[model samples]
Target: MNEQTKKQYTMAVLNLLQPKIASLVKEAHPVYQEDLEQELKLKMLEKMQTPFLHNIPSFFEFVSSNEKK
Candidate 1:
């Protein structure tokens, strides 16, 4: 897909998945649930702002590089 479409799809998937993830996290930890959700939302927004087109590496490459770091 084109860059715009890719970004939109990425966001759509994140939107769909985030609530389920947040729910699970909240269920696991009853305290500070709202804070966790807010923190996760902010982090997601920060990650989404970084374009994934030019600098994104393969999954294995990313994992290995992070391991090295």
Candidate 2:
């Protein structure tokens, strides 16, 4: 995808995950929440570009006790 399209896709994905990101940022310092959310979004966007997304894990995989490295 082109840069613009990749950016649009990233924004869409960020919008879809806004609630989850908010929840994840809730524990962060109030002053840093905004920055934390932006950083998390950037990280997620980076991950979205990786081969890791090809073999995506189930949602349960994240919260499970037996996570693989």
TM of each candidate vs. truth = 0.45, 0.58
All models: lDDT? 0.76, 0.86
Q: What residue runs in model 1 are displaced by over 4 Å at the alpha carbon?
A: 1-14, 53-69
List of clashing residue pairs for candidate 1: none
What are the per-residue Cα lDDT tens digits for candidate 2 across 1-69? 589987798789889999999998999999999999989988987889898775666779766836654
- Model 1: per-residue lDDT, tens digit, 1-69? 598997797679678978686776767567778777777777776776676754789899999999998
Instruction: State in Å the error of residue 48, model 2.
Output: 1.2
